[model samples]
Structure formats: C-alpha cells, structure tokens
Target: MQSIPYSVTLRPKIFVFTVMGTYAALAPIAVSSVFQHLLAVPMSVLLTMVSVCIFAVAWIMQREETSFKALNRIGISMILAIALPAFLSIAASIYALTVVQSVEYVAYFQHSLLNRLINIGMFATLSLLILFFIQKDVRKVTYSLTQGYFVGLSVLVAGGVWQFLHFTIGYPMPGFETRAFVHSVSEDVLINFRLTSFTDEPSFLVPFLIDGLIIGGMLLSKKAYSLYAIPAVLVLLLSFSVSGYVNLAVIVFSATILLFARGIIPKKVGLYAIISILILGMITVLIFPQLITALFMPIIGRLDSLFDVMHHSRLYMLVFPFVWLFDYSSINALFGFGPGSYDFLARTKYLSHQGAVSGTSNNAFIDLLFEHGVFGGLVFICVFIGVFVYLWRKRKGHLYNSIALLLWIHLGLTNMYRSDFASPRFWIIVLIVIGLTELAKRNITLSDRRASSSYKKKVTT
Candidate 1:
C-alpha cells in the first residue's frame, strides 16, 4: 500500500493531540478553587472555548474532506434523540409560562429555559466538533482519547493522595482553601477524612475513580493501567459517597449477570475479573482498616438512606422532581414545567410543603423526566437503550467495545447523581467510543475485501 501524504496526516494528528491534551488538562479542574476563581467562568464555558479553538483547527485541516456523508445512521439517531427533546422542552416551556400563576414563577421558567438552551448548545457544538475530527481519521483520534483518559484519571489519583496527606498530616499545599472549597464536613478530617482530591466534592470525585477501576481493570488489560485501580479503590473508599457505593454495587451485580449468568463476556475474562476483585478487596481491608467501613456502609447502615429521601437532602432533591411530576396536573406531567423548572418548584412548592433546603434533582433521569415530560424522557431513555444494544452486539475482542459498554453502564448509573451533562466525563467517552465503532467497521470491510480478492485469484489460478 502507498504511504499517505505527510501533509494530509500531520494536521489531523496535531488536531487530535491538541483536543485530547486540552481535555485532559482542563476537564478535571472544575472544582479547583484556584482555577475557579482565576477563570471566573464555569467549566462548561471553558470547555466550549477550547472546543471552538479545536473546531477552527479541524475546519482548516478537513475543509475539503468534511461532508454530511461522514454521518451514519447511529450518528443521525443520536442527533435526533438530542434535538427532539430540546424542541419538546421549548414547546413545553412556552405552555408552562402561560399557565404559571405569578410573575415570579414566569421568571423562573424563563431562566430555566435559557439555561437548558446554553447546556444543549454547548454539548451539541462540542460533539459536532469532536465528530468532525474523528471522521478525518478515526484510529488516530480514538488512540489519543484513550491515552488522554487514562492520563487524566492518573492525575486525579495523584491529587487525591495529596489531598489525603494535606488534611491528615498537615502537609502544606496552596489553593486547597477548605473554607471556599469544602462543601461539607462530617467527622472532621482528622477522624474520618473525606478525600475530595481535585474536584469540588467527594461524590464528584468518585465516578472518575470508579471509571479508572472498572475500565482500566476489565477492558484496558494493561498491568500499569490495572495498578491505578489500587489507589482508585482506596480513594473511592475515602470519598464516602453513598451514590458511589450504590454505583459500585450496580457494577458488581451487572457484571455478574453479564459474565456468569448471561455469558456475554468470555469465561476466562470473568475468572480474571473475580480474581482482580478479590485482590482489590484484600488490599483494601489489610491496609486501610480505618477506611474499610465505607465499603460496607452503603449495604448496612446507609442502605435505608437511599430510600429515605426526606432525611437525605440529595435523595430528596432527586425524588422531588418525580413527586412534582405525578402530583401536579396531567398536562404538566406530560411535558414538564420545562428545563430548570425543578429548581423553582423545589424552592416554591417543595420547600413550602417539606421545609427542606433548596436543591435541583441531582438525578439526570429524574431531571429529564421532570423537565421535558413523559414523551421527551422516554425518547432520551430509548436512545440509551439503543446504544447499549448496539455496543452489546458489537463486542469485538474486548477493547473499545467492552470499554464503551461498561463505561456507558457506569455513566448511566453515575448520572443518577451527577446530572451535569456538559461535563467531559459524560461526552468524552461517548465520542471516543463512537469513533472506535467506526474504525472497527472500516477494518472489517477491508478484511472482507482482502478475503474476496484472494478467493478470486485462487479461482483464476
């Protein structure tokens, strides 16, 4: 085969590198008091700015190559899934505004609609820009993203360790500013340290650590990558996030059903997985006995907290949206009060009744259902179900397919608490997996062509 032109490859390679590097550097810094104060802007806005720059680079590099033909059925489906909700939401928001009794409620609805538009706009723009680069060279982009993902997670591990030491041993570190940064403190850092690491809160940090543990152990299959699991597991226990604990249970249960019960992943892989879990468990118990209670708290003491929404503000915040959905008018339930309407309701309706602190539905599923109504919520859910089935069918050799599938499962559960759709943790894995599936299809096509050509030559001979 002839070598591709140097100029043709060089620009795309640079674009991929830059995109991954920016994401790795900036995505995890959302909670940093230093960076937060320095930028004086939300992480979503920073990501959008970097994306715009990356998009410009992609346009220059792939202007001639870019086309609507780059999109496939799967891509079209994702676009429609996202777009349909926005339209439904806007229509619903307009209707809600007409019925709202007070001017105060109208302002709340308008603010919510604007916020939804910004989030959707940012997410859509970033996704399209990344997709454009992926279309240029799927393999290069996928490799860069995977490398960046692990690197970013490794950095988080390091940060978590530092934070643990800083709070415990009085290690001097700048910018940790607990007054501004620490969201809540239970038993104090000396007694039972909650490791926030680099992120704003413990719950925010748990999902990333979980990704490192699961994806790194099950899919990546590198010894070095697997080692990250040790510290990740350690930090996860230290974080003391109930949602994280629930997600861990979900991961274990789902893997058991997928591996042993359904026979989806191979048996050999399942054996190794069991061994890995055992080893991680032993290490956690032996070394960190003080922190070991965290592993069991979710199942033992805190299990009821999951159901007791009124006592636990986070759970209440999550369930409040659903309560609002069913209790209110059928028309309101059909198409929610509009995006961001939950916050208003939490303050006005929920607070008045329950006297709980103001909060939005931290759960994305609840948020979607409450904000967009029944039809819109179902569409969003169906899209995920479709993607899950697609990934399951395309489980080729336990690399990208396996990584994407498990990662999606993790993200799906994590979204119950972590509702920020604009976060890189949500979109980066998605776009990378999409690119990987495309590359996999291309490889299969080439292999088929080669086999066909060889058969024709054999017949001729």
Candidate 2:
C-alpha cells in the first residue's frame, strides 16, 4: 500500500488546524453573561468559534458518507431553532426604531437584538460541537465541562485562601480592592457575621454554590456515591432566594436523570439519592422555619389582601408588565420594543426598575413572546417541542440524558434567561445531557449496550 503524498496528508492537517484554531477563538465569544457566572462570557465565544470550525470538518469528512444524510434533519432543526429567535429580534428592532420613534424604546430594541444574537450564537456553537468532537470522541466535551469545574474550583480556592490571609493580617492593601465582610446587627436578625466574597454577595453566593453542584452530581459511577450531593443539596435548600433554590433543583434533577438513563447508577447510589433528598429537606425545615412561608406568603396573601384589605382594587402596579405588553403598538407587539428599552422606559416613565421585570419581561413566557413576537415565539415553541418530542420518542431509553434536558427545560420555564445555559454549570450539564442523549438516539449499538451490561454487572458484583 502506498502512503498518501505529503501534500495530500498536509491538506487534512491544515483543514483540522484551521477548524480548531477558529473554534478556540469563538468559544468564549459565544458565551453569554448568564447572571454572574463569569465563565459563561468566555465559554460562549470559545464554543461558537469551535463549533463553526468542527462543522466545517464534519462537512469535509462526511462528504462521501451517509452519516450526514441521516442527521441532516437535526442539523436543519438546529439552524432554524437559532434563526427564529434572531429574526424576531431583528423584526422588533426595526419596529422600535421606525414606528415607535422613541429613544427609550430604541434602547429596549438594542438589548433585545443583542440578546437574541447571543442566544442564537449559543445554539449555533453547540450544534457545531456535537457535529465535530461528538462524531469523534463523544466523551471529549463531557470531560471538558466536568473537568472544567475542577479547574474553576482550583481558582476559587486559591482566591479564597489569599483573602483568608489578607483578613488575618489586617493587611491594609490600598490598590487592590478585595471582598470584605463586617459583622452587623440587624433589627430582624441577631448579629450576622456577613461574608462578602468576590463579585458575589452572601445572597448571590447561594446561587453560585448551588450552580457548582454539577461537580458532585457527576461523581455518580457504577459502584456507589455516599449521598455526597447531600451537602450541596442542603445548602441550596437553605438558600434565602427562591431562585437559588431553583438552581439547586435544576442541578439535582439533571444529575438524577443522567445517572439513571445511563444505567450506571448503583442500588446503593439510588438509595442514597432518595435518602439524601429527604434528609436535605428535613435539614432545611430545621434551619429556616419561615423560609418557605416567606416565598409563598406574599403570593398567597395577595388574594386575601385584594379582596379584604384593599377592598377588591386591581393589582394594577404589579401587573404593569402584562398591561405594557398589551398596550404597545401592533408593530411593537409583532416585534418587541427591544432589550433595555422596556425597563428603561419603565424607569423614565417611572414604572418598575426592580426585580426580574426591571429590565426584561417579568413574566419569562410573556417576555419571550414580547421580544420575538408571535412568529418568533412560535419558532421557539417549535424548537422546544422538537427537543421534547425527540426526547419523548426515545424516552424508554436514554432516560438519564432525557432527565438532564428536562432540568434545563425546568429552568427555562421558570424565571431564567434562555442564555443562562451559557454558564459553566448550565453548559456542563447540557454537554453531559448531549453525551448521554447521543447514546439514546440509536437502537442501542452493541458497544453501548455492552457498556451498559458491563455497568450492571459491576453493580451486582
């Protein structure tokens, strides 16, 4: 057999190098700033660039193959999934500038446009990742996110230690501004030794910690896990913010789905998962008696307050978002006003500049509708439906991967930014789901089935 010429061999290498280098540059850019998860910002850019590069590779390698034909529908779905949102935002931006003619409204469109672009960018990048590496080493992306956490943690620990030393020394470092905490007595609570670390406040830290929890969840192997996710579970339970608790729920639920779907989770581990969840629930009850009360009490009491206390008056102020959504022009209705425009107008008009509704739609569903309009919203719904139907069709298998996607779906339904999935926790969990889902997309390959059988054998052993 003759070896391919140096020139021909060099061509493949050149193509691969270009794809990878471009991928590296775009990964971080594609990342959206999902809340305060700083990692999201860079990861998006990296993921996007990488995705495009790999997609090119897929096109090249599969040029003479049947794999492309088999999966082309999914590819098209992915493209349309992205395009729908971008189109909606663009349409909205046009409406805001041309029809509304209001500077404040234009600002909103600007934000809306940028956000849609970022969200589209995310989907584009991920589709590419799957096309490239997943086609080669399916585990490559999974290991990156799981292992990436370890990398991020190492940084967190180092910073923590440095801060610990700074406080110990009373080091009056002037140039370097470090997170500081002070003990303050409040009227409601006793002297609280508050700790402000990094860009995160004590309150925000709850969500941050909860987000890091995928690390523990990924520890689920064939042997057993010692309810290790329990500690993180408890911390999330005791979190003051409802959002923080929700984040925790997302992590656990996703972890559970992934482990169970793969059939690698041991009986001991399953027992631990159930017990751990219940135990964490009990611990939460012990620590914060009024916690649940605080979250729901306001929502519940409103019904009585409207009828009895306020004498059946409308909750007009609270319902400003709903009213605004309807009050906008037909053009604005078809295409959202813009991003910062909504809340910015609210501040200028002095409506609401606080809470989730402060910037975007307070109601996520409505906000999605408002930004993308009906058509764009429909596109989103279709993508979700496709994702859901695709999973449901294969529900009997790939249970773990389905569960992971379910958790993402759960978060998406709740008050979450669509782009939040750009965060490290979100992306890692997503890639994990992707890895597992790919296993289910087929009629159990002999190797995968054998892996599952082997996993089961180890469990019984």
Candidate 3:
C-alpha cells in the first residue's frame, strides 16, 4: 500500500471537520446574541463566509494533480444530475425578471436571485472539493467525515439538552437568552416545547438528527460502537416535528426490509437494536409520558382531517401547489413567475390581509416549480433520481450506500412538508453520498487491476 503524504492526510481531516463544524455548531452559534451583537452580522451571511473560507482552504491544500480525464469520468453523472436544473433555474430567473414589470416583483426577484446563486455556488464548490479529496484518499476522507459527524452529533445533543433544561426551569442561560426564545414563542399547545438545540429551529435540528441516525445506523451495522445513536435518536424523538417522525419511521421500515433481504444483520446486533429501542421507549414513557401522547395526537388529528373538506390538511398542502402552478399561464408554466413569486402571490392573492407571507411553499418540488417553472422542477427531480440510481447501481453492497438510499427516501418524503433544499443539511448529505459512491467505484477498479496483474504474473511464471 502507498503511504499518503502528511499534508494530504491532514488537509482532508481539517476540511471534513470544518464542514461539519460550520453546520453543526458555528451556524447556530452565529445566531446567538453573543455573535449577533458582537459581530453585527446575520447567521446566514456568517455561514456563507465560513463556507467560502473552507472552500479556499480545500482548494489550496490540493497536492495531488487531478487528471482531466478522471474528472470527466466522475463528473458526467453529476453534470446530468445538477447542471441541467441549475441552468434552467438561471434561465427562469432571467425570464421572470424580463417579463414581470411590477416593482415589488422585481425587487423580490433580485434579492432571491442573489441568495439562490450564492447557495448553489457554495454547494457546487464544496462538492468539487469533496470529490477532489475522495480521489486523493477515499478511506481517510470517509473516516474523517464519519468521525466529524459523530462529534457534531454529540455537541448537538448536549446543546439540545441544555436548551431543554433552561426551558423547563424558566431560567435563561446568560448571553444566550435568544436561544430560549423559540421554545417560548413556538411551543406546541400539546407538545409544550420542541427542542431545537443549537439549530435556529426545530425543523433544522430534525434533519441533522436524521442524518446522524443514518450514519450511526450504518456504523452499528458494521459492528462499530454505536452509543452515539442513542442521543441522536432521542433528539429526533424530542423534536416532535411531524415530518421528522414520518421520515424516521420510513427509514426504519426500509432499513429493516433491506437488512432482512441481505441477511447480513447478525443476531446479536438485531437483539441490541431491539433492546435500544425498548429502553428508549420505556424511558420516554416513564419519564415523560405526555411527550408520547403529544407526539401522536397531532399525527392522529392530521390523519383525521385528511378527509375533512373544510380543513386544509397536509395532503392539501402537498397537492395544491402543483395544482396552482399548472393553472398558470404558459409562459409562467415554462419559466416560473420567478424566485419568491409564490410567497409574493400568497401574500397578495390568498392572504392579502395577513401581511407578508413569511413561509415558503413547504414543498421543495412545488417551490422549484413556482420559482423556476416546469423545466427547472423536472430537471431538479431528475438530478436526485439520477444521482440515487447511479449510487445504488455502483455502491450497492456498501453499508453507506444503504444509508444513503434511506436518506434519499427520507428526504423525498419529508420534502413534501418542508422545503429543505435551502438547508445545508440537504446538500451535505447529497454531496457526501456522491463522493462515497465515486470512492466505491474507484476501489473496485483498483481491485480489478490488481487481480489482472496477478493473473499475468502467474501466466508468465
């Protein structure tokens, strides 16, 4: 085996930790009163700055020469998966700007255009950096990534517990009073409080927990220490976010099926998994009985309301946006009315008396259609499907691949209730899976070459 250069090895660890730190800790900390008052900058801008710095560091640390041919081979599927949607989105934005003459619409479009461009560019740059690192040293890079994820999850869970304690005791942590505000203002009537931990919102926390669970589960399947999964699963349950619960259930259901089909899960591990779940359930019931009741009531209520014609249930929220988009003019259908147009219309047409519509469409696919039209929406869908199919075909036997598939299913299902595309969590998982899949393919190629060389040596002898 070839020895990796010190710098090459060190850089990837630093890069992975930085990416994990930015999302898991820094992003949330940036929103706290300490940073807000001291730095006089919003959390979003601070996150963007952090991402840019990380990207620059990764670029500067690239020692191995990346072959154009190698890049071409790795990039072809990604281009089909990402570039088409991006191009269509840009085109839609331009078209909307040119045709929509309203001053309000123009201002909104300009603001959204800048934000969307920054987010897309940042993710793209990070993805390239990840791919480069994978090409250089796949094993080291992946190990670093998984370790970072484990550390980040610990931090998030500790922070969440602290936040929950403060909420329960009615004593605010000095200099971090802002963190408690969400719990105070948005506590569900039934659930009492939703634990967001270090995240800006409960919804934000849920996705990270879900990702953590996926990683933890993968590690557990591989006979690695999986104690971290306990807190990860706990925080997810405490979140009490409907979408979060639904996604968790789906992942668990699908994983069970897969593990059974593969017959790879050991009896000991299966017993451990069951005990963990039982222990967690017992703790919840004994310590916080109301929590279970609170969690289920909303889901039950929502299901009952699904058939209620007078109520706007989650099903309606999922279906109405598409209906509205298709009803628009042909020009608007081809290219969306522009970014932020849905919120604009919601405010002006549907809820004129409710002031500004502060929420997104809550469905990423519908948001894509409303903001970038049919072309962009379709391309975006293809991007997800193409990447998933590619990974599934190439890395089928790897535990990480199963986890990635579960993550994809969770994201696809949960995105119906929330637009998570704008979140770093969504892109981070996608990029990591892509990098891992590429690494798996490269490993297979290396094995084949070694086998061929061995055969030739035997023949010559």
Q: What is candidate 2's lDDT per residue for 1-461, written digit by digit as tens?
A: 34566666556644554444444322322222332244654554555555556656655664544355444354446456545565656666676676666776656555645755665566555555444555554444434444444344333333334444455565542223322332121223221222223323333334334434443334345232334334434433432334445555665665565556566677688979799989998998779877654544423333443434223211223345444655657766665555324454454444222233244433444555655555555675676567667665565454444444554455354334222322333344445455556544542321324346656344322
lDDT tens readout by residue for model 3, 174-246: 3343322323122244655567776655665676667667766544443343566666676677676667887
Please give, for residues 180-279, the per-residue lDDT of candidate 1 as tens digits.
1322333223234567777777777888877777645532446665568777888787777767888988887765655553345677898898899999
Query: lDDT score of model 1?
Result: 0.66
Off by over 4 Å in 1: 1-9, 31-34, 65-69, 175-191, 214-221, 252-304, 326-329, 350-359, 396-398, 444-461
Top TM-score hit? 1
Candidate structures ordered by lDDT, highest first:
1, 3, 2
Candidate 2 least-lDDT 10 residues: 183-192
The clash count of every prediction, one per candidate, is 0, 23, 0
Q: Best-fitting candidate, measured by lDDT?
A: 1
Candidate 3 similarity to native, TM-score = 0.73
Instruction: Give all TM-scores, in the order shown.
Output: 0.79, 0.61, 0.73
Q: Is candidate 1 or candidate 2 better by lDDT?
A: 1
Candidate 1: residue 365 lDDT (0-100): 74
